[model samples]
Target: MAGPKSGAYAIAAVPLLFIGTLLGFVIVGDEDSCVSTVAAGVSVTIDPGSVPQTEIAGYGHEQLVNAAHVIQAGKDEGLTVRDQTIGVMTAMGESSLRNIDYGDWETGGVINPDGSRTTSIGLFQQQDGWGTREERLDPYVTSTKFFQEMIQKVPDRDSLEPTIVAHRTQVNADPYHYERYWAPAVQIVEGLTGAQTGLGGASPAVCGGSLVPGEISAAGWALPNTGPVTSPYGPRIHPIYGTLRFHAGIDLAAGCDAPIWSIQDGVVVGRGFDRGGNGYIKIDHGAGIASRYLHMYDSGMFVNVGDKVTAGQQIGLEGSSGESTGCHLHFEVHINGDTVDPDLFMRQVGVPLG
Candidate 1:
């Protein structure tokens, strides 16, 4: 995710339409792209020191302060709360919400497409195509540059998933790389501002944060999906294999694109497609406990390899990807590396399967 780092809008006289519907916003840009903006006098401020906690989303005071700069940058661009959250999430994934004097070449060096070492630096990990080295090092400047790009690149971002919008803006290799930071970014934004935002309103059901939400048990467990269990975990004729085999997990039919929450906090140990091209996520929860979810489309996955996810945090959206015949989640619980009945295990942990 690298490019021009100029902070100014440079917005060429794009036409504007006054949307007098209850929310009253001025829509800027063309049909394919819409930038939601309030009246000129409306403004936002970010007080990093006002955050009650010294740490947020695993980041310390300095890092949260950097995120505040990002929020202010997005606000200055008149971006919605969701778009601002995307800005912060992108920075979190790229630079851990901190600015650095050097870039890709100095850290984990990588050759660019033209065979030159990557020049990615700053909060957005921008390349030389961005502004001067000094500009990229400035938080509000770099973040403003980022929001300007997002407004031009993302189409109808107000209706799209925040992670997808970030992916489109940054042009990252993995479309979902910014996903894990989403929940934390929402928390940081709301906590710092002390106001409920439109972050996840009308957005995809990602039970991470936003006006929507998630729930976890005191035992550190959560239901993957609150839908009905369509299939139990046990030995039976394989639905696709056509042979008598053990079904390693229980199947829950939660509608397509429904959020699939992680049942326990853990590191994502693995993710890959099955024979039918559907995807799966395996998390190791320690104490010999682990869980797996299957049948989501590749893009539906929210977290990635090595992402430390929390209980009830969204990990993926349900889909009929692999050998699946329809939309649902094939959820499995494991103990000591052996498959166990998820219904029984979750029930034991006070997170009974639906």
Candidate 2:
């Protein structure tokens, strides 16, 4: 298995959409292009601290605060702190990084302003018609796959063109296209979550204060009663989308109501449901890293938002909820919003996968 920096991985980029009559096109050969010149020419400036009043309208401040813990995991995984900025930027750009329920207006076979039918789908607006449906919607799977592909392109932090190419080949094919917007995107991520980039000259921290939600600490590894690890982090069959997305966390086959254990000591910052995340918990450990427990039994959640917890504590029971096939824990590790292998982080902390 290659580390996160290896970009040898190739997965489908989110298929493009016309959005409105604003779409323009160019024909390379026999194929009629449906890309917009405005999209091609326009530079996207992301103010990391500025939340779209129209977008993310319903989420409470606490909900956004809790989600930041998961974002910080990207940093812990050894990615540049900018990876967190880019990840959140990608989220904002892709699905506004929002876990949405409604489908594209053209979801079931509708045409775009360019007369092309919108077949691609989801929060990042990934398309199943272009890539496998299973790969598109799984967040960890898609995110890891995206990072793997992007890392191949980024020779260094300064050259993110390859990474952008891996994710949005059509819109980002020109190297300089996204350059103007990259800093803004980074600013948006850092500003929103209160995470420090440690990068010089970044805008002031907006949401200053970490909101790590559950208990996480360095200690001995006691596998949850959830059973043998059927799917360790990295590419796996996504139960919900029916495609291949990177599994950021481990999944163990277990019965519903099984006791879920905390790997370390921390605080509970988020717990709730709707789509995508289903039932989840986030634990924050100082040092800009955090752990996540997702898709568990809602009825069995022991802690709530803002509760502090210790190592090996019970935060929630395992179950099959929102976007899951069976009862299992979708475990994840994030440092600065970049997802890294939790297993690697675990071993570093003296806990073996065994």
Candidate 3:
């Protein structure tokens, strides 16, 4: 009987001891253990700081640092995120964010390949006339120079398409070359700053908080049509006219009468027929961002010139009303009156248009 009782008491004491050990560990632990289990059961969230240095995927640390410099330089000059994005996009298109000492006809500050240095160097690959070799190589100076030139040359740069603005400032041979880099540039800026680019509208976290007028929503955007793109936005031979022409917008082949939706919230600015007789509707999405829907059936417009529309709201129906061989929607995105590739513009705003 005594042995049995003693055994039972030991068993009970063992559990108590184990519980005490756990409690002790919880209340007081060595540095390592404490750190490991300090908040094991509690949720912990860390908000990013201003100018957060979060690593951008597929980018080296050096590239990220240089990108940060561009953003900071833009801010220093009181430029908006749009301007900073333009500078970064230009850098990406020119040098992939590297400050090379060589150019088209030169290498390592010396002429190579018999006139290979085209006098373009630095993060922006600025020409020799931009400044001295040293200044061009300096990321800050080059970015500042680029921004100042953009301001001086393109006074309405902020309202213009990023690639167009970059083209005007750089005088590059290809106007749309930098267009493809807009999405990456936006990602880099967001990754570094932990803030939305305000391309479509204010980010959800900062919505309704001192938003700049004409700022696109950072929350998200909508795809006007998910159908296969019949004709992409760019230079191409017109199917109907049989002439080389610039396709200002993308063509989505959604059978006739397919609903065409507004990409973002905005007031309808214009609704009329183009010279080609294609019925169209234009929405001013603020922030100098406007979307146009063309080739709607001549049945009339769903929203009027003064009507305010919301994202995903049906604005019209797709049709081959103007200059069309078949039924489709010709969607155009205009920034400050310059037509940009609708597909690229959609991708930049986080809504990829295929």
**Winning candidate number (lDDT):** 1
lDDT of model 3, residue 18: 24
Cα lDDT tens digits, model 2, 218-309, are 45444433456767889977866889988888776666756676667677666554334366778776577788887664334556666666
Sorted by lDDT, highest first, which candidate order results?
Answer: 1, 3, 2
Q: Candidate 2 — what's its lDDT?
A: 0.47
RMSD of each: 12.7, 20.5, 22.7
Candidate 3 ranges with C-alpha deviation above 4 Å: 1-54, 107-117, 200-206, 209-354
- Which residue pairs show collisions in model 1? 3-130, 4-130, 5-130, 5-131, 278-322
* TM values, all candidates: 0.47, 0.38, 0.46
lDDT (CA) for every model shown? 0.70, 0.47, 0.64
Q: Pick the candidate with the highest TM-score.
A: 1
Q: What is the lDDT of residue 184 in candidate 2?
A: 52
Worst 10 residues of 1 by lDDT: 4-13
lDDT of 1 by residue, 237-263 (tens): 878878998889999997987888889
